[model samples]
Target: MDLVERLFAGDKRACARLISHVENNVNGVNEDLKKIYKETGKAYVIGITGPPGSGKSTLTDKLVKLLRKEDKKIGIIAVDPTSPFTGGAILGDRVRMGDLNTDSGVFIRSMGARGHLGGLSDATSAAVTVLDAYGCEYIFLETVGVGQSEVEVMKSADTTLMVMVPGLGDDIQAIKAGVMEIGNVFAVNKSDRDGAKRTKREIDMMLDFSKKDWRPSVTLVSAIKDENVDVLLEKIFEHRDYLLESNLYHLERKANVKNEILSLVRKEIMERVINNDEKHQLLEDLSHKVALRIENPYTASEIIINELKK
Candidate 1:
């Protein structure tokens, strides 16, 4: 059987192969995705993001165990930071989630950010589509712990959870502007720590400044201890319910599709500029011209774009 057929037939290896194709930008993968696009949209996508050392993997492990109890088929895409030298993921999250490997209901994949700056590999959205079409009822996308400006998870997730831990002075202050704005649910992981209450208060105060229609809820939990994980799950479902009841789910889905299309278009244009011999030569020439002050960068870019049009 073909890959898509095998995927629909619940072949785990097929699902993994398809995901690899998407991640690697394999030839004709987009066509394959188009063929199965209609089979998607069934799974709920949840994004978990935070700063480094926030215990997101532990929280995800506990959450997956709870999800398994309900007999839900789950897909987990864990984004790891790429090593600058080796160009591979360091501290593979799969090791932390080893117990779930034997569970047939769970499918876990590790992806390297590969120099992408938005805390996710560029293929993450496409991976979600493949898993959704594979009949996963729930898909969890865990991003590389990120700092300010890596808040891209918001554009993709149905419900975005921001995980924070206490006792890191000034870290919250640093990300309060960017990461704080993206969370639908705020989780203060390692709630047993000394400053957990203070961290929660800080989040509450920051949230009060917003005039959004829906308020983000903050819950304290010890992921390692598996404490209050059920409460966090309840908050997740509540946010999902709110989105569906308010018709925001469809709206978000539309926006996500638009964003995906725009991203693909941008990537294609960049590839053409870099890979085509004539365009590549033009780029170098334009760079020299701009460096010598023979032409401004804006004008050089316009020339390149016009050349692409021709």
Candidate 2:
């Protein structure tokens, strides 16, 4: 049997291999994914995003443990910062969740941000797609924790959880309009620290005026101490239940599907334009004109696009 068949047969090694192929951009991997794409849209994606040092990883670990209690298969895609020199993730996957390796129910993958502005890497959606086809019931996408721009997580997640800590007033203010509005559940982690209530109050105040039909719940929890974590999980479930009951799940899924499709189309077009050998010299000429300000970029782009039509 081939890799996709192995994946359908519940082979963990095959599942890991497929994710690796996606991450590394192996040849024909896109074809492999096409064979399994129909099996996707089954797993519920939860996006966890926040600023650096917010203990988002710990919170995810706790949540997975809770999920394991119910015998649910879980997939975690943790996107960490990339090292400028090495262009690899600064944090290792095993180091982040050493204990979870023994559990067959959990699959963890650490990916580099690769300078993607939205906190997730280019391969994230693909990795999630593989895991979904691999039969994971829940997929956790932990972002690189870049502030403000992390709102992109909402596009891929069925429900997004914005993590906060007791401090970092500036970070909170910066993301208020961005990730703040996108989160379906707000988790004020490290609640044992001072100002926990103050932080929760701030989120509550914002949600009040936002008046979203699904009001994002803000919960104070200490992941290290395991305090209020169960409650946090409950709030997450509540948000998921709300989406399901209100029939927003299917509607949101439609939007997400459309968004992913459009994004893939744009990416494919760009790749084709840039990688075309015949247009290489033309691109250089256009760049030179645009650089010298002899020709505006709009016209140069139009010229290349017209070539594509030909």
Candidate 3:
């Protein structure tokens, strides 16, 4: 049987292989995806994002363990920082979450961010689709510790959980700058650490100024000690329910599909028009012209685009 059929037949290896293909942008993968795309949207996508050393992996592990008690099928996509030399994931999460491999109900995959901005790899949404189609009830996307500009998870996930630990002074600034806008729920992980209550109060105070249809919930949880983890999970579920009840679920899904289509169109144009072998020399000549001040890049780009259109 083919990969899609195998995936539909409950084959983990097929799922892994298909995700790999999507990540690498392998030829004909889009066709494979089309075959299985209908099976998606069953899984609830949760995006987990925060700073480096925030124990997101550990928190994810704890959350998965709790969910598995109810026999839920879970998929984890850990967007690890790319290795400079190999251009592949550093695989830190794989090491931290290795024990979860014993559970057939849990599937973990680590994807290299590969310098893609917005804390997630370009293939992340597609990989999520693959897992969602594979019958996962919940999918956790752990981003590569992001900053002010990396708030794309809000667009991709049904719920966005921002994980922060106490003692990071910079995070206080980060929250005020833009994270406060994207996060659906705030988690003060490693609550055993000093200033945990202070951090929670700071968030609560900051949240007081903002008004929305659904207020974001802030919770302190010590993942290592398993303190309040269940509460945090429930908060996430509450956010999901709010989206569904408010009719934002359908709207958000519409926006997500629009973004995905636009992204794919841009990618296709970039590959077929600008990166074509026939255009390579033209691009180089335009670059030289621009470097010599004989032509500005705007006009050069227009020239390339017009030429391609003809």
TM-score of 3: 0.96
Clashes by residue pair, model 3? none
Q: What is the C-alpha local distance difference test score of each model?
A: 0.91, 0.86, 0.87
Q: Which stretches of candidate 1 lie over 4 Å from their true place?
A: 170-175
Task: Give the lDDT of residue 84 in candidate 2.
Answer: 72
List candidate 3 stretches off by more than 4 Å.
84-86, 170-175
lDDT winner between candidates 1 and 3 = 1
lDDT of 3 by residue, 1-310 (tens): 9999999888999999999999999999999999888878989999998888888888999889899999999999999778777785566886667678889999999989887878898999899999998999999999988765688887788889999888877435745767657888999998989998888888877777777777888999998888999999999989988888988999998998899899898888778765687787888899999999999999999988887797
Per-candidate TM equals 0.96, 0.95, 0.96
Q: Give the least accurate 10-residue stretch of model 1, judged by summed lDDT.
A: 168-177
For model 2, residues 1-310, the per-residue Cα lDDT tens digits are: 9999999998999998998898877899999999999878889899999888798888888889999999999999999888777786676544657778789999988888776778888788899999999999999999987676567788899989989887778435833567677889999999988888888888788778875687788999998888899998898899889999987999998888798889788877787788898887788999998999999999999998898888
Candidate number of the best TM-score? 1
Whole-structure CA lDDT of model 3: 0.87
Q: Give the backbone clash total of model 2.
A: 0
In candidate 2, which residue ranges exceed 4 Å CA deviation?
A: 84-86, 170-175
Per-residue CA lDDT of candidate 1, range 70-103, in tens?
Answer: 9999999999899888896674788779899899
